[model samples]
Target: MERPPARTPEGSRKTPVTSGLAARAHRTFTPPELIRNFCIIAHIDHGKSTLADRMLQLTGVVEERAMRAQYLDRMDIERERGITIKSQAVRLPWAAPGRDGKTIDHVLNLIDTPGHVDFTYEVSRSLAACEGAVLLVDAAQGIEAQTLANLYLALENDLHVIPVLNKIDLPAAQPERYAEEIAHIIGGSPDDVLRVSGKTGAGVKELLDKVVAEIPPPVGDADAPARAMIFDSVYDIYRGVITYIRVIDGKITPRERIQMMSTRAIHELLEVGVISPEPIPTVGLGVGEVGYLITGVKDVRQSKVGDTITSAAKGATVPLGGYRDPRPMVYSGLYPLDGSDYPLLRDALDKLRLNDAALTYEPETSAALGFGYRCGYLGLLHMEITRDRLEREFGLDLISTTPNVVYRVTMEDTTTHVVTNPSDWPSGKIRDIVEPIVRCTIISPSEYIGTIMELCQSRRGSLGGMDYLSETRVELRYTMPLGEIIFDFFDALKSRTRGYASLDYEEIGMQEADLVKVDILLQGEAVDAFSAIVHKDSAYGYGVSMTAKLRELIPRQQFEVPIQAAVGSRVIARETIRAMRKDVLAKCYGGDITRKRKLLEKQKEGKKRMKMVGRVEVPQEAFIAALSTDSAPAAGKDAKK
Candidate 1:
């Protein structure tokens, strides 16, 4: 019923082929009509990766002995976290059952995408290379925030969506209910939703057959001028920048001169290949095919994702649509624990950026934390992944400041500035301030609707609309300032709803706000990195809490240290860290009262001298603890004893 696996090389075992051996196996290329470019879209932990693994196994592209869960997840962090951090593409040969009950060979180009809200950009690029998408929904959990989000993206891309209800083998799975929900959301018959179990491989063959029958083949002309879409790329130390491309028209061959439409850069193609889950070198990739190209590109900026690749001699008149640079939603400062490691961190970031084009960073200096980079990311998870990679891969110990969102400030001179870091915030400019706003959507069980609304109200969210998805499930929409949620809103929401609530948000625009900059001063010296912009109404309370937290975190110095929270020249809150008292007269046990007085006075003079000359040493952890706004006991409750 299926084609046999490719013959292993002499003396090679039936295991996963290493990159070298895979390149050596010269394979025949399928015609464009027989090729289907598709991707899997789903919510996090919704069995997208498992379904991909099963597809590869059934197609005989990967041997069962070498089959591990999420075989396409190449990153170690991805495997450890059990999440798909990066989108991966592979080619599989399937023997689809035709109308006459005869088996026909079909080439399937499958791109497995990450299901987190943070990696939505990655999903978009992956979808650009596909003509169809498999929308996987969990039968037990039903729909989620990301499921709808990705479904809309697939529809926007005009891809044929095949709804597959997964995890039906589970005892708790309610396949019928989810099928009805899918039908309601996507406008399909309940019976049309294919039921499958990724764990047991049930209904998988039928799903594949449906893919061949339903999804349309890519349309392109081989005789036309060469035009390809660069969906993704990675930097290799030996081969330089390797770009993954989908050939929409014509063909790309080794030694062919290619030009990037956006950057207007030209290079000779060093190699053309396809990913058999690993790089497999090929002579050329033709129209309606997906593969990779090596062009000796050293700089990642030149090989921008979503850029067009065309023949240098006769380039396309216009680039493809849906090409926009990624804008960061959250900003933070990344400082090396040791300032000398700055260069090492910079180099590591450069290499990492080659793979992650969404990450943005620039050098920034802090008065208290020394030198670091102000980094911007798509979401909180993106920031976490970048930090983890820097520490684990580059072996650098780092400190991160509190995350913040960009704000718009209108000055008295009629000029506006966008501020990402607190130190760069123009507090002296007298005028109005506008903060970014997001349209927040939350879906949860009706029982937790009250709790969700309360949490939203506390975050200054205004209810926009509410709808009942089903009798038990409800979706709520709200408009809220982006600043309120960048810190711990998601964590709080999950805690309040017991992890049943899921959230999705999109930036609406900027709105006028009553805002003020709050500064933290230690011993009358303002710490630049400790400053933050907050609403005027909450400034006083926030200042008091911050001052109290600082008093607890800062260790006692030889001299009394004054911790103050200020708005411009006016101090709003203050706390004092008392000096540690010591017995200088301990040695004089039997001395007279006069002798003791003179010793105490001398000790006092020495203390005064030390206080004037010494600097208070602030621990690195103090900065992190003070800036972290995670829920803690009331400030006075943790007062220093």
Candidate 2:
């Protein structure tokens, strides 16, 4: 008894609800054996969202006419950029027809995760809420760097992985080749790999059947004490904090008192609900079920991700394992454009942090940039997205300094200090400097291997290994300092490879290096915010390029302005901005020789007075140019600061 696809009502824009009130009103508890908790993992732009959309339609969670591409991507930035930044969860009532023409009702809890390396931590949290994962690979593009990274993460978490090749409708799709690649990576039979086309709705029903048959049901005891895992949280003005969770044991209902094992804060559950693409209030969610809890916890910090929720009366002594705090890799200074907006900026950051737990910041002051916050992020993309959200969502104009990686400095007294801000480099007391390093993996076409190798070596990266995925595609691995890739490595890679290469990296450890703090000085005054840490061997070249860029951006003043880059007390590069000239004798046209001499004398005196009192005003763009390595003029051209 195969059910036909549901259609939306005529002239109706609302998504047709199949199991909202009816499912919640007469909700009989689903047995653990009938529930499947799983998630979809893939590389960026690999059709994970499309497959999820198809699944939602097949289960009649949403009508066909109401469907939109990438339906799980809710944020405006996500939709505009075509990337999934946050993980979304939904519950669907799927029924598979048996041989006897009877239908079996099965509950499917699907979580869609982000594919970017910056959001890998979010993916990990989403995976913890599931018992299995659907590994989606693009048939045309094949295996990518992030695909391997995420596959390893799922394996590490002991989740069952089901390999599925998507986009089989494309003319260039080599399903057999990609299937074999998946088999080589995950150690399974190539024939076992399921193929589906998300765009054409071909082979989707078979894929759904495979999911139910191959994926195991979640295991947990409902009669035991209540315990749940909080994987994500969001802030609401009226509801306060809404926490997305997965029930592991027992059950949770409205008005139940629950305690967060990590924070020990207790709150009464105001409401419990499940997401059917939209929130549907439910009576209770039992073990092996995924849902949300409204506890009136005003601050999202209280309902932390990876925290365990248990009954207040009978709490679990040991919480679930694999809970680790997110560590920020990149650091930058964020300052309000107007000095008076400091308090407003602080409030905005507090509100933003309530929802973004990975963002770390503290009060910091720079002599040049003034009062600001020193913020930390997971990676470069994380930093960009956070900054963009602050400006777009909070309506704040901010100035961001150059991003830097954390460094460990050992003092002469054998004391080790972590340096996040380049201005905080204690050069006098430091005995040795250790910089963070990452193991980078790049997947690209074989034709661009030479170009990529050149780019890697230019960044001071050493080749670790290489592999031939196929005759046309290759995988290259390198161990490089994190700072080298923080600036423009991805952009350069895309430029050189014609956007065919994908990158993924993980921090390996720290190693001692000959590093120095390079300072940019304007008119003999050091700008603390413009200082950066670079390798000693490349400091001179970087200084030259930075000074050259600043020279073009800074405006001329009444007195000559000298832009200099120095390490310690040794100046390595310099550029000068000539003072603006004024013809003081223009008004004395066709006058007597004595009158001309008097005018010249007056002009000379005025010039001396102006020079004595005038201070060169460096524009904001000059500071920005000084901090950006990409702002330098093109090659084979004169670049001076």
Candidate 3:
């Protein structure tokens, strides 16, 4: 391939490219042997992004003048939050000295992944694209729940795991202690763990050297039929859906027709390239290489993550072992604040789904909230970030209901139904109701063990076990109902532990429980949007809190509105929204007793007529305020009482 004119040897951008607007190009493809694919995985705030910054500088893939903190983090939300929500891949060039005393140039395909448990799917997809992982642990903070979780995921994929303790320059750094802890976990000696300071850029060169030497190169049949794995993708308004893929077998080039193995969707490849922190159009991507492909795919759904990409004419016979779909543990109703924005909301979600593959939604309607979609999320944080992106990126005003989990209900005749929305709870169920359960891992200081246990128990969690990561830090395992934790457990856990505790949870099937669907009724009419499914033990508390909250939100109407939270025919709790009073005796203040009596009689008759004719109208703001998670803390307080 011919080099573009006036290009630097490093292939760094010469022209001033706007920040994250478009990828700056770089190129000069290398063979499969010199290519190394790996990722950095750690707990949040453990310096994964900062370390990535240091590597960017060391490799000179992103020049110092243009590079900022978290160069791989392209989203404004990610930069503002100082977190990597999406897994980002970039290609960098390195020249490592070989054992034979010769300097060998290498192509390093580095993927920076999110550490948050909500974005674990992103990490897993990134994992499938690599043959090795750099397990990053904070020297001061030691191993966290996510660090361990991500480590296990890497090991499960049979990838080489390299242990590294970061932040050696911190005042509270305890590299010696954490190195042993990391070694014990990874089945190696403490001396095997590499130490690096991301803040000071200490020991990074050695870490890179270790990566090139220790991690084995990816092996694939170069002459075989073309095959690539679609690990991640983003929707470009100008280019349509751009898929990030890792080539496993054969090579792909521009102008070639390709087929998605899973969906059988075909598109002519418009461009093929590698991201040297930017998209550099390459002649082709060979085996064991990571790059991007532009197929002019408008609908992101057609290019599924974990789907195989192959030549439309001479595709591979079999697809690779793909990823399991990320099951949504939390479900919420996302209604547009304005009714007319419903169509816009759907379109926005569809486009956002291109960038975010884990997002799932279906059309749902509520009498109180109107037209909307019931969206599924991996966790509470995932729900929050996705909603924030929708508002910030697409300019959509979204109102999300309180998060809940799925349930399985069996009827007397043995008919089974899976209920995701509370409003969809089966009415004919007479046998058993089972709710999703999760194995939650909470790591915190030992002093907070009692507080953690108390919080877990309050949420109906059973003690699975407990272990000491160190003398002070302890890991507590609990099996809790997914519904119980999705609402306020994480917030409460953080607050109770003074924000020292880190939590990670994975759904572990379902268990039968005494559960009931609590409905909020306004003047004998059930508001489906405000309904919730709760355990029988906390049914009264949920009902009471919901009714009380609604009473405060819903304005006083012409007729008295009774807000009742009922389970079946039984009303568990009720709050009356009293009617606005009219000063009926104002004209009769100076009149006789008979005149006042007549006025009072007329007023009473009018009240009766109003009650008979008028119905309660719960405003949109009322529904938004009632169903929002802002009521979560209040509900927790009430439930405690």
Model-by-model lDDT, in order? 0.82, 0.82, 0.84
Model 2, runs deviating above 4 Å: 1-16, 19-26, 97-102, 591-609, 621-641
For model 1, what is the alpha-carbon lDDT of residue 169?
Answer: 95
lDDT of 3 at 196: 97
| Candidate 1 lowest-lDDT run of ten | 632-641
Ordering by lDDT = 3, 1, 2
Best by TM-score: 3
Ten residues in sequence with the least summed lDDT for candidate 3 = 632-641
Screening candidate 2 with a backbone cut-off below 3 angstroms (N, C-alpha, C), the clashing residue pairs are 547-641, 548-640, 548-641, 551-641
Candidate 3 residue 94 Cα shift, in angstroms, is: 0.8
Q: Compared with the true structure, what per-residue lDDT tens digits does model 3 show for residues 1-641?
A: 98655332122344433323123223344578888899999888899999999998888766567878777787888888778888889787777987797988777899999888888899999999999999999998898888888999999989999999999999999999998788767788999999999989999999999899888888999899999998887877667788889999999989999999988888999889887777777888998999988887778678788889999999997999888988888888998989999999999998888778889999999777789999998877788888889999889988998788888889999999889888888777479988889998888999999999988898889999999887888999999988887677766887898877888878888899998888888889898888888889999998998898888998898668888999998998999988888887776547579988888788788888988878887787887777776545332221111
lDDT of 2 by residue, 480-568 (tens): 99888877778788779988888888899998899999999887888787788999998998799878988889888766778999999
RMSD (Å) of each candidate, 1 decimal: 5.8, 5.8, 4.6
